[model samples]
Target: MDGSKVALVLATSAGGVGRHVRSVADGLRERGAKVVVLGPASADELFGFTESGARFVPVEIADRPHPLGDVRAVARIRRLTRDADVVHAHGLRAGGLAALARLRTAPAPLRLGPAAPPLVVTLHNASIAGGLTGAAYATLERVVARGAAEVLAVSPDLEERMRALGARSVGLALVPAPATPPSPDLAPSHEPESSQDARPSQGTAAPSRAAAVPPEDHAAAKRIRAELGAGDAPLILTVARLADQKGLPTLLDAAAGWARLDPPALVVIAGDGPLEAGLRDRIAEENLPVRLLGHRTDVPALLAAADVAVLPSIWEGQPLIVQEVLRAGRPLVATRVGGVPVMVGDAALLVPPGDAGELERAVRRVLEDRALADRLASAAVERASRLPTEDDAVDQLLSVYDRVMRTVF
Candidate 1:
């Protein structure tokens, strides 16, 4: 590699970051820089970087307060950063890993002629932390900020949040999320039997938002109705982590109020996390028609089959799933948060975050008024088209890599 040429040390502790890291790394590679991903096992399991032409190095992440794990993470990062012209961390885990890396001692790698790569952190979410633990996280973030050479915030919401949390010394840049609206096609190439392909095919276009809707997905909806023995049932889908912020409990409470006349209305909550057992129990106890799907890649098809897509999150960081929902051209009923307003634009029926009654009314209105659903879906499609495309997001990522490399050399 040329001494001036750059390298990226991408890291993440979640599935979403894999998409962003791979997109950025792929873009950087296309722009002629060597890129390496210091991602987690989950990220690797979800998105295989090796097959995508980038080197994948495993880096275990410590979820704050784990001093020993932090030390190990830093040591691992130091080894990965060796010989790299620029070390750019992708998300929060990558940020912490990069900060830890700076603490590790190393004789400069022989490959570097003069310039040493500066450490960088990219903040993807606006919330630093929540509740009592936030103070500790804030202090740690400030410490990390002081060690970093630059801090990139994906959204203005994130930038403001960081500023509020007291991130001063690090050079800050608002990188505006570079995600594009999904493809318009309504079918995914992978079959129902092959859903375990898990990782996406390398170099494939980012999954189209519209592809979330497949004929089979609609059939699944029909199947659910058949199982419930309620033919011609109206369906509402919520694809999100079942947590407080995602507002699942509130959604279920609201589901209790829906009065189905001729055909019963059903609310399907897909994707799973900490709140699964509680949510299942709540459904059983309350006798709500809401069904819980632990987790399914069949989401796109489910979204397509549904009457409406609801994201009642108290907060969000430019949810890719929302983009997928929009690409499916489904009417949206979402809580206004983070870059959600930016995603939904005027297409979605927005409600105050955490207001179950309002959420209920929004869904009911869409269900009762087919014209409104059609209008919302059409508007969603138009708004989705206006947002940046995956190609555009890739270009912006390349620009970031190029700009960071310039700072190093």
Candidate 2:
């Protein structure tokens, strides 16, 4: 977009959404597009949108809906996006607020007033709530569907839902991969069945790094293992914020089952959030073999140090951790939910979202079966090579903006 003015709106983002918006701002600014990011002041403080070279404006669009707050946010968004060529909103609540501002009325109460600058909304995650909360979110989905000129979805399920809700145009949004680190080395396994071949096979796209692990990574992995008090036992790693959506209870349940294994696996969860205290209580109460390593910055080392990685999210939208795991070339066992199956293909063993037994089985296979682990690790590297880049995301985003502009103008 040569000098096109684009306003990016999002809610109070703390994790992937915040990083993604910042990445978009950086990419758009580098391409000479005038980008303005509007979100909570805390998000700017966390993600540094202004540091990414985009003009940062604070408009409090919250994760949860509030009557007075929504009104204030709608007014702020409407005023800020008035001069832009296009307005792109991320997440459900932020998109709904932007849509209300752009349409000038609740479409159910009255007809759409005007689509002045053309609105585009990106649906990043699916609703996991039920009953009244789910219904409220569904209503917002319809509002966004009816208001946006075009909608971009992060997963197939999200795209299908938007289309069914009557979105004008719906397409898959490409989440760019996280920065790649040096591929991890296979951990020494004490299990009789494990310790088989764990290297890339003959392939054109296979990672060209040597069989030897990077020295610094090796040292870091050793340090992390010792610090965690994991001696000869294998390390089972999960890198997720301790939240309901992450299905931590199921992970703990699986950990309970694995606790009986001789030289039982040490489960390490390396992120923190609202559910930290609850998860900590469950671990102590059940005496589960799981440790919470709250809000870590050394994920690459954690991946390198682990025997196998697991993700048991109830729903996810192209999670950056999965991409990072693939780049690390670690064997993964993730739930077959949302974008995960498409992301991992045959690179990971897929289990149902809440099935602790199946999850335990899949993870155990990677621990006990050496050949499977090697194949998954090799396949992960091949998959990593094909994931979308930041340039690809910007090119696709510009295409959407261009098309929407042409239609609106």
Candidate 3:
């Protein structure tokens, strides 16, 4: 395929979706394609698009749907895509905007001649509740599906959901697990330290070279364990957003009874969201053995220090955290929802969603039964090996772009 100019659009600039878009943009750029990113203005500060060598165009798109915002977003996106060969939008809101921009309406005539650039949308979530808000989102989903040149789902379950939601051409592109570097490679390089020491100090405080250097996994893990008061005790780590869909409340309910075990477990939840205050309240009232470390950047270290990783989500579309757990080869206890079972297979102990008792039992078994834990960890390593890499995902995505562009042009 020729080097095409692609516009990668996203509504929000935080979380896994933002990271995925950045990786895709970087990958496309590496392959000689000109990548332009369009998202909320916050994206510039959040992801550092300029540092990554990608041109960023800040668009005013709200996280939630608004009539005026939608109109403005569509207009901005249309102008941005005029010179783009492909427009790839991430999430429902961005997809809807891209779709609206591409639609051949009387009021909004095609500015880029008869054919607009192919719009490829990646649907990240498959679960939505049934209500008026859900109904409105469903309408937008259908519009996005119909307007998009191709729809990509992150998991098999989500692929099916997209098809049912009116997406004609749907493809599955599993989100790759985080690649683990070698132990020696995980160590911080001394080059930055030497440079910092040699450089003359200015009157103003210089930026910390510590932030530039990667932390040693072993040291970081020990530090995290100490902070959590997990002294030789089993560390059950969960890295997820504190959202309703994550079923964090159910996990807390389960944790309340964990003190009954022979040697009580220590739970470290490393994420922040809207439900943080409520979770803190519930933990205080119940006196559960759980620590909420809001939005941690040391997930790899936490995983290394964990005895078991748990994900008690009500719904998921092949969660990246679950994949990270498996990739880290940590024994997993995740709820059997969406594409989680498909992801873990026999490598994780799957419990029913919202079943706090079952979640509790699963965690206890993984902690107590040494042989079972070992078996799961061993299986996890093998399963993770079989999973696709980010490079592979990028190749599959570029293939879709080529296929769509061929048809469109």
Indicate whether candidate 2 or candidate 3 has the larger lDDT: 2
Model 3 earns a TM-score of 0.87
lDDT of 3 at 179: 59
Clashes of each: 7, 0, 0
C-alpha lDDT (0 to 100) for residue 46 of candidate 1: 75
| Model 1 residue pairs with clashes | 180-388, 180-389, 183-208, 209-327, 210-327, 212-300, 212-301
- The TM-scores of all predictions, comma-separated, are 0.79, 0.91, 0.87
Query: Order of candidates by TM-score, top first?
Result: 2, 3, 1
Task: State each model's CA lDDT, in order.
Answer: 0.64, 0.83, 0.78
Winning candidate number (lDDT): 2
Tens-place lDDT digits, model 2, residues 1-409: 8899999999987799888888888888889899999999999999987765679999998887688999999989988988899999999999989888875565443354464688899988888888988887988998898889899999999999999988899999988764644434333334322112222121321222222234345555667887998876678999998888998889999998777665678999999899999989989998999999998887888887777899999999899999989988888999999989888899999999999999998888787776777788889899988999988988999999999999842
lDDT of 1 by residue, 218-297 (tens): 44544454554444566678888775668787788788776442355778888878789998998898789888867776
Per-residue lDDT of 1-409 in model 3, one digit per residue for the tens?
4478999999884578887787788888888888999999887778778788899998978777788888988888988898888899988889888888886552543333365788899988754567876776787787776778799877687787778877768987657754545554246645423433422232211222121223444455566667787765677888999888899988988887777654567788999889999999988998899999999776777876777889999888768888787777778899988878888899999999999999999988877776777788888888888887788878998899888888752
Error of 2 at 81 (Å): 0.5
At residue 197, give the lDDT of candidate 3: 43
Candidate 2, poorest ten consecutive residues by summed lDDT = 193-202
Q: Residue 284 CA error for candidate 1 (Å)?
A: 0.6
